[model samples]
Target: MPPPGGTPDNANYDVLVVGGGPVGLLLAYQLKRFGVSVCVLEQHEKEMQDAYGRAIALFPRTLEQLDQLDLIEPMLQLGFACRTSVTYKDGERVVWTFMENIQDTTYDFVLVLRQMYTEQILREKLDAVGARYYHGMKCVDFTYDENLPRANYPIVSTFVDGGSGEQYQLRSKYLVGADGGHSFVRRHAGISFEGDSSDDQWIRIDGIVETDMPLNRSYGAIESKTHGNVLWAPLDHAATRIGYAYTAEIAAKYPGGVTQEVAKQEAIEAMKPFKVNFKEVHWWTLYNIGQRLANSFSVRDRILLCGDAAHTHSSGAAQGLNTGIHDAVNLGWKLALQIRDATKLEVLKTYDTERMTAVQQLIRYDKDISTLMSHKWPSWYEGDRNADPYHVLGEIFEKTASFNTGLGICYSENFVNQTSALSLRVPPGSRPPDLELSTPGTDQKVRFQHITRNIAKFWVAVFTGNINATRTPLRQLRKAYAGMRALPIDAFVSWITISASTGCSPYEALGMEPFGNTYYDATSCAHERFGFSLERGGIAIIRPDGLLATGGPLDGQFVEEYFSKVMQ
Candidate 1:
């Protein structure tokens, strides 16, 4: 494996990622795992070390997806396990149960880790896989050609080495901009960035702090008449994140503009009635919020975008970083499949369709939360002028609890998430319940996602409701699935037979060899969570990113039909 800041071994790659943040690093890592030649270009000389960056919360679904990458264990070690949320006004508790509504999965609590550590962990994984990301590299400009014979490497990207001030070119089959909001690639490529910017500016400071409020180590908010809705989040390593709207009136107090000292002072004032003292300051920022989405996420499908390059929004709901993670995982597998078989280009198209829909939903939610956090009603508000923004914030907050936590993000029908009877409770396009299962008779517990590792391949979960009742249909499903080798796309799938019956092995328990890998739903919780009958079995097609693609009865032909439509 090349070192973190090492030179690329080759100038040409199957995919060239333009940013080396968490999203780009993870996408590159996943593509490399699938045998795709991938490299990343990062403008920063190195990932952040001492200073923590903007994002701090990783919601439930984000953690679940990270677990699929086998990266969550390290992150959990560095994050604070925050379980509850509290809001206060003048030291009195205010009821807001929106954040407390997160349910299901092992990662029920939000993992509160700084963005710098998140990026570092991703880079470490990328390094272990030998994927090279060049540092101090800036993508200046580039052009593409389809008329020429070198159409396979359609996108030619030009970069300037930040260290040497030398310009160079690298060719790739695809160019992805995981770059930040002011993406050089997006602007240079002439992609339209459409959205509105709020005059509301907010101050967020990360530091070691002491606070008298209970649930200080968890998520907390304060209604400050002067500071608006104050943010009091407990971050990793005994750190507290204090944030408040840097209102125009407060800005007027410092016409020279807010300094780090000013930011620190304001944080203390924001948490009035309850005292807070900063022991150490790690990082802080004061900036205006905006919500922008690219008119298109892909330019001719060769020049694609993800993460902040495709969309930028407020940290109010903390969707900014979580959405980036979603974009990376969603794009990683699709791009890898497309590169492996050019005929499956449609799979790559679904990344844009899927993420754009999710992004639109996020933007609509952010517009309200961001305004509310600043103690202002959104433009759509029709209630009385005397209405409290915090009250309104509470109502809207509860409704979007599932989405804000990322557990309920469901995509529209597409090739990857095809329309079905939607029979299962965890239907196509929705995230599957990460219920616990066990090794066939060992009875050792294992998470459903652990069995479905993130290797840019789909996981076919054969839910055998009960061995005694469904053995015949299970065997028929296995034989029919075995016969699918003629299609070629079947190679991209991994299977696990989960039986509701527990025994020594598949042979001893079900009178059949393990279909692919034998697992026992010892408690029948997995079967129940998946909406599978205790007597009748079925199959679920889990996409590479962990969303259920399509599912139906235990009929191999049904499974084959899905793959045939999604891929050759």
Candidate 2:
């Protein structure tokens, strides 16, 4: 907890992540994977309770990002798949929403699992890499030195052990606040959490239940005359989470008494015509809702904020954890590159810009969804035609389906996502579509994401139309790759040749010395999905986080210019 007693030094750790929740754990995992020294600090003395009355929905986009770390399969094994969202009004199904694999993701539907389990899986990944995760140690103060020597640690963080009251000082090149809404790092950094709080309160229950409702098998909601709006979803084991709003009258009903017994009674009363029996209760909570975002995500190009520390919103939309996971993935690899000095300092700024844009959109969407679910219509939509709350919520859900599923998340055009003049189908700042391909001269098939699994480096796929045409670009790229050997660039950049020709092997054309492994777009899906014309071959640079960075003509100079902008 005392951080092993040391002064802040660059030789120690490159990055110090506060709060070992899912986001912090993920940041640590990625940094370690990138060979960057990282240490995690958790304020809690031990693992918190399964108080996962919080985030339980893992959208498809999140699963795709998790696949990059090879952690999705284990999570899929421990969670339930929620493909449909059913909403009922007065015990009759009114809006049944379906989330398909429209993005062509490996994990199509939302996975319902406790947040604790999600954190555990990420912690296991960190443990596998021998990363340090210290619990009970909380950051009490930090000092940022902008003028310090570049080789030395710029941020000096002090921590104290909750158990022994021992104090320790640690140093890092970067400090990240992944702590929750009441984050000390955010407050100490003097960053403002801007937003408003809503009066709508909610109570949630998770446990074994017996219900006559036929739609309880998956994600469902109920809009009742008596209960308000209730969320129904399956959980790990034979458990379910039933979350319902608490009206002013209901709050008054429990006025001198709000206990588990009272909550259970209220839950039963709210279900109206459907009979719901609870055999056991695992967890329950009563809480208010608020929407807030940090004024900035990163400070001085070093101190950063993520997860609940960066933003907060109601659980009604079930976006709290899902959005936080996105924040971690977006920032993790960027920070790793920054630590290695592989990317320009300005490149790290995109972490703040891109994620802030996404978080702000989430806030706007959550505001509408929360209001509708609470049966409180905003002033503009109060007419009889839009009277029904269930109908309105369904409409908003349809409109914002992309954000909800994490598929529609596309970063704004920036240094990293310049418009590709090559006219590829996948635009810069958007994730490359997942398509099936195979190794050169072999029948082994693989998903396009398989090539994108590594988070520490960028992958440049040279789509040469034929083996003969690959000779020049391959030779030039091999020379460029050799030039990068002197720098730590090899740690952050990789090259691969993808041939559209079935007659010749990509391995023989490029040789295995420079390009690690050649892949064949035999099915022609890659060619179509990437908008690659056989006449005009192109090179697509996939970022460390699996987003398309840039694409242009298949020339060595074009590849060098792309790397020159991002790497040292």
Candidate 3:
């Protein structure tokens, strides 16, 4: 049912996303592509002018998400692709890790771009979809009618337009807060942001620098010691971003309270080992470190929080924008489905469970990275002379960087679950590799890329040499879980039949040979490297984000029973 006074014809919104940052805008774009009506509210009158200088790494998973949205080509054109990163301490080189191992996977390299530029691209996408956004509208309050049944809860929101003193009220069935740290929507919902704020302040600068620094040698550089840490990386054409972090003692000792000049000087000093000299600076800012996580991502019957609104941590991890955008992707499709009246409201609860878990894992990772980067590590002199401290630190650096890039995120215990008795050639929580496949209906060769879209949607991939025997059960399952209950029956499932005689199987495109009785294709190399294990003959349930839900021997009864458990 639509909210009161809503236009009867178009009175109900499938989802209302607050904040117009990259994450919120991308969420709206994805939902709109699925035919969901969405409205976004942004407190700022316009997009940000300056770069945030926060995230420099776009992990393979994030790049895959961008590719799914068809924004990769433009992004790749605008940003620099980083294939390798090196870390140095004092004069000793610690570690260097190349992205080549993961190249055949989802992302070949991390794409570095300014946050402002990223937001601009996402805004253009939203415009293309005809999604609506209200600028200068800051959400001030939210109310939920809990008296209504769980499925029919009415969400009301009040916002004060910065341009106009007049207040406006909007009602929707679902609300998402993608606002950044210090989110008004999160506060209004009375959700606790529990964490500690570091008193240490860090200065960041980005601009066209007159420096005799070599750029083509490595994708990026990081230098750290007991005193502080500094980073220099290429941005756009003829520009670089330099970041320096100072301890409280060093910040206090510096005259004029660690101003941009002081930071610039310190950055120059740190670059002494590289024999680099800077003649000019472009942009700079100083900020304190803080880490926090919302106690809960969802509240009452009306509100949900995502992105920085749900959790925040040190910039060292470079997860700020990536995680938020992912949150938007995870929630957007479900909100759209509920608005379309195709899915029950219970599905909304799963958003909290799924995303909150990911956030918690991130928090832990951030804490670890902070400890490693900060002055907590013992001095090299304190360790055994034979034990090279730099080598030990290098191993830790590689692990921390890997986690920061989001390659470590796993969803083995998501709310959606089903069990199968058939042993899949590939296991659950893994992506199906792309292979040459023949669509059962058309007999045309199709890759996994041809079938699955990156946006959030449930998918059921059935691998069977015997299509005739499986067709009846597959159809019945499709009818039972069609529409929002699963992937829309019309768009979700892809039926393929493969045999050795077929020459190329869908799994082969994914660079894997069918090992078990069943085989399926993967869209990207990331899916196979991280998730798949050779096993054959069975059905695999994949979540909207491409993570495997569960797999087993092909048995309709078992699949239905598992669905029954999770749908409740």
Candidate 4:
């Protein structure tokens, strides 16, 4: 139960992640990558591990984040590209081919893979990082001790072994509640979840089927009078998901409750213009629609909440698991800094501010989409009831295309996002565009995100207008890197110089020993895409999470000021 050794009383850990879901394991993996002592406690036994009927579609931004971890290749191999979406009303096609406009990203299409497979991939990464993952461990309760000496490990958590019923206590510097919607940690911490539940219920089933209707592997939606609306998508393992809403009459038919027989018949009836037969049923679920958010994400700066423990919404937009993954990555680096004593405790507050803002916007979006998909008009609606809902839903889908695609989610200006030094189209709080560049040493081509995989250092990218003028800025950056006290040399910050001139080799000009690797912008694409000037180079401080923290002229004072906000 306790790693085959006797349980130690009051065990020590840098961070205690209270759930073993994707979010919790991700948090643990990131923390351990930076050498932070972290452990995950999950109540589910080893036998029950599989995709729990959660999210399946991964947006472009999520894929980019995974790419930074070097975890995107395997997922791409296992998942199929869902690049098109078609919508119909009463068996007549109304809207066809959505997502054709999102072609600017590396992952321009949604990757359809089951959540269970995603968990398996994350578990492999977690094991590679050597993080401790414990299953069948239940966290019964915990105590927060702010007044205790050496507040580094101020939280005491008591847990019961799910396999042996043995009880023990653990001391950690911080606690994270990545537990799902029914989170025990959130309740124990006295956080209030605020939201409303809708009367709309839906059934989703994954199976191999035979149908006369065209079920293109691409995503599709059908608006029906008897069954409400239906969402169809191709899943892995020769299976596809067919989900439909329960209209008033449909609900009345199953007064005694829905069964496999009833669900199959309802699904068949929902597809009115076609004949359907199910060969095998992989998984099926009945879920109610609801939206909720924790009033506060942190309790006195000691206990933190993330994932479903912090926010909950219906899966109509496929935002539940994607949002949770966002939350995990956003909080991972900030927590690592606090544990390493590299930054002030106040930096942790930004996690709540940034993530809460994103989650609130997500809740509003999910509410609108779920309401329309359920075939229910708003209570204030006075329009004609005969009008097709597909027209209005399609309009909303196009309007929020950026946000729904995950690339449009940006954080508000905070201490981390000090100010913009470069007059670029991309703002301070948004992710920098991925650009291609070649390594000077190996002459190898790579994306800008490839070198940003490490979470321990801030990538100070200094763009030089000319090779002759690069000496001064590179010297200043080297000095700034030397004086950085956040962690240690190169571990806390790293520098890369990009020159616009093709004739000048960075390895030959600037000493390659001081700078890890230099880049050359031969075609000037990086210069044009990043809003950097070919005549006048610019400086951008890329945070550990790849968000542009600050952009400005290459001056030591500006770099010093930015680090001051994070270090002290």
Candidate 5:
């Protein structure tokens, strides 16, 4: 199928995402939300099959992001809520309870769902947003104009739609390679993936099992020495998902060592101790474990890499999907800014620097997790000795589990300064917290999520010292930003006018502590028990990711000037 007119002169899209997996879908959704035109090309015809039961953990941070996007409720309805995770070693339970302790936080539980299901949900969302997708279209080659300056006309891509014998050519101001491990997009862009591919072969099995022991659970482990070290967890009421990792030497010893039957038998033997028995197997596959990161996220300017194209690690912590999704969220808004003229193309270059650093951190963390869980004990009985093994495992589990849910991500180092007081108010790369405020004339309470749907403009929270003096400027600012009235000011920003001396709470239900004593209430006083100061009269500039862009003393002129320069 030709482009109808054989590739129109200016048919280039605002952004070209290479992969229709969850990561690419998210990128497309976020861009569309910002009113940017985007297209995703996937090498596969449809969502992945159930045989690949990968990605069981959706961290709290990711859940919070879904909530902000209005996808969390749907996701929860489809997936299982994982409140506690158990860790076992040498047949003995080490950490039987790993509960996330973030009651005061937005997301406190990880959601467990298969990667295929996750991709399906994201695809549905992408469709609703009017984002286009080309399935079974493989990107074979890509080229960038090195002769041009860094951010100008940098990348071009060539794709072959498998459904129809058609060759398509497209140009993009920004190109993201979300394609999996053997990424053709990343390779064509001349990016090198640096890391090692272990000779270990792991088999993952998902199936229904009947057992007297508690089933339908989420657990991690470093056991099964007789067969191989395996990590196991539950998929649903009838089926459980288990991964068996074996060394190359052992596999070489047995010709049929990596078969599903072998893995299923091993899993069955491992579960016998817990009184769990397998009745039948539904799906299984052998996966090679590799850990690698792209040397750079971008080449020249237009081509960038994310997800498995950028990094891959062992399946111990289920970090692959989480990291990939985070990459999509990070790059989406930046690309949208350039596409919508809310920011210059220069902002796009920062995507590589920021995302690459985050990926590297994940790689390091994954390595640590693999090593800690793979340690072997002399015997299953040893797990009963003195609680020392349990203690050691507990410490390791705590460290591995301490990863900041995507919500805790901050972009303080690149493209934005974190030390400025203004920056502090608006976390540049952090997720913005949902705040409640009332509509000026309607007396209706408005949420940030509702207001952000139609308006994608950057917000400047004007925190005036006195409510009366600020009213005139607030009204004037609103008039000036009338075109952007669809976007609401967060309650924290609107309540700035209330004299800090009044001690009035703007939205009591949110349990928002006053900026200082002037707005303190019983809840605010209780929040003070945490030993953190909540000062008032400061402005916070938040980025699209909901993180504080910057914060400082409220200066109307400075706010206007900042927007004029960035939005130009």
Candidate 6:
């Protein structure tokens, strides 16, 4: 018998997020942290979150973003910090490196962990944060109307409980589809997933295993003759991920079709001279590689798509999950800002604009990387066919290393990223370098990222130059900012002041009370790192997602000017 249908007292929310994967959960978690009531529905039960291989790596930039949410510390405890990779040929060690190009952040290594654990951490924190989370409850149907009297809660979604056979409706101001690539929400929302699919098949197997190979604990690959590029990566808890191309040769050998045994045997074959023994097999998968993106991310001003639901691509670059994290981080604050101020509809548009473009760039890189991994040269490969794919891959990887690490990801000029007068090594729409700073009285050092947690506010960082010399501007800025302290954007802005000394007291460092948080750039390296002089300080507006909005000479007018365009 079907359970009763009724909108429970807690049914209504500010946002209804469909899908409870890492992306959906993180987005909902952030929305709740930003004071927005949210509901996250995942059709799958917790145990079934990921029974097979999915994303296994978190890049440096993503780690930084997670730290911004204060979630990385627990994640670090469950993940392996991978800083080195070594490739081998015929059991001979060969030089190969990854993620060495990443800089400006304390999270400088690729974190190796299972997707389930990552999801578990998110689920636990989501509960602690008090967001509505339901597993085995699927969004069966949803509708929206601008004509509704409660325009703030115009989205009504009906969800079916898998266990009880019960159904009910939850209303929200907007609906976000974080469902995976084969998204029911995307299809229902009439959003078209557009892109190309390739016939390349790949296999990934994860297990607690023993390997004779040196540096087996790090990320490495074998130059497999039969299986193309073979991946060897150490995961948390003594497990290793073995991945290789499931080419036609492997299929031919498995005329009866492949099984777990085939996945195991082929992995052994791919490793060649390296000894392999699985103590316990955990998860494995055979999947096709494809690249696709939703034609639209935000729809009808009331619906949005994120994570795999908005874009899809091969996992060749280890970017599938990382890019999704970026999507959620980018969208979370914007959604929070919009939900708080409905008139700020313009900010939501940038989510589609920025992420779509970024994901498009990701697909291009993955396409090249995927084709190379398939042991096939792309059509654009003008080089000799006899050239080693590894060599070509190395060249391309070196070129795209910064992007691959998520540090070089840049956005074009928009309302959020406008022209700035301050000449900084980092440009607008790019992330500022993560440097160390000291506390006022305690003199405790902290990462700049640790200071600017993503709290759904524009962090106005006022660089108060050597207070002994530039105290006048600090005093002047203090006066100018008073007139704008209670502006309409107060709900979305934060303040921090940094000076160039490890003064025992914050008041002595700035010659006045600091605006928000006070930090000391002891050696002024943080200033030089951001391309500013400690002798001549300035102001920088960092968006909630940690991207530098704009910077200018020590003045509050620049910040006001930047927000004028954003709020307008």
lDDT of each: 0.84, 0.80, 0.62, 0.78, 0.61, 0.84
Of models 1 and 2, which has the larger TM-score? 1
Model 5: residues >4 Å from true position, as ranges? 1-11, 47-51, 89-92, 145-155, 220-229, 236-238, 248-253, 376-393, 422-457, 462-522, 525-536, 561-565
Model 3 segments more than 4 A misplaced: 1-12, 47-52, 89-92, 103-106, 148-153, 210-217, 275-280, 344-346, 378-393, 400-402, 423-427, 430-450, 454-456, 465-500, 503-536, 556-568
Backbone clashes in model 2, listed as residue pairs: 8-171
Segments of candidate 6 deviating more than 4 angstroms = 1-10, 149-152
Worst 10 residues of 1 by lDDT: 1-10
lDDT of 2: 0.80
Residue-level lDDT of model 3, residues 1-568, one tens digit each, is 1111111222446577888878888888888888877788788755344335555557777877777778787788888787766556556664466454453244657788877777777777787777776677778887888766534537877777676566877777778888889888899888899998766666677766655444433455555563355666777655677766677766667756766677777777656566555555766777777789998988863678889999998776577888887787777766665555545566666778777887887787566555445545443335554643345445655665555555555555444633335444444544555445444324665545435554555555544433344445445544544433443343533333233222244454323333222233322232233232223334566666665667654455655655554443
Q: Please, what are the lDDT tens digits per residue for candidate 2 over residues 96-148?
A: 65654245777678898888788778877888887877887878999988899
lDDT of 5 by residue, 205-257 (tens): 88777654442365555455444545667664336777765555456656855
Q: Model 1: number of clashes?
A: 0
Query: Stretches of candidate 4 above 4 Å error?
Result: 1-10, 49-51, 90-92, 150-152, 380-385, 441-444, 467-489, 508-515
The digit string of per-residue lDDT tens for model 1 on 1-568 reads 2345755554778999999888888889988888988989998876444265678999998998888888899999999988889999879998876556777778888999888888888887888888878888888988888775433687788888887887878888888999889898889889999998989999999999887878787698999878988988988888889999999888889988889999999899889888888899989998888899999999888888989999999888888889999999988888888887833678888888889999999998888898988988888889896878888888888888889888899997777787664367776888887777778656788888778765577888888887778878888886887687555766788788888877776777767776678788877888888888878878888888888888788888888787777776
TM-score of 2: 0.92
Between prediction 3 and prediction 6, the one with superior lDDT is 6
Report how far off residue 465 is in candidate 5 (Å): 7.6
Q: Distance (Å) between predicted and true CA of 436, model 5?
A: 8.9
Winner on lDDT (1 vs 4):
1
- Least accurate 10 contiguous residues by lDDT in model 3: 1-10
TM-score of each: 0.95, 0.92, 0.81, 0.92, 0.79, 0.95
lDDT of 4 by residue, 1-568 (tens): 1221223345699899999888898888889988898888888864466735567888888887788776798899898788887776656666565567775567888888888888778778887877777777889899987787545587899988876898978999889999899999999999999999998998888788887666457688777766666888888766788889976678887888988778888888887776778998777888899999999989887789989999999888888888988898888888888777777777778899999999999898788788888877656557786886656667778888888788888887787876786787668778887788887657678778776766566778877665466566757766765665344534577777766764345655554333455777778787777787766677788888888887887676777777777775
Candidate 5 Cα lDDT to native? 0.61
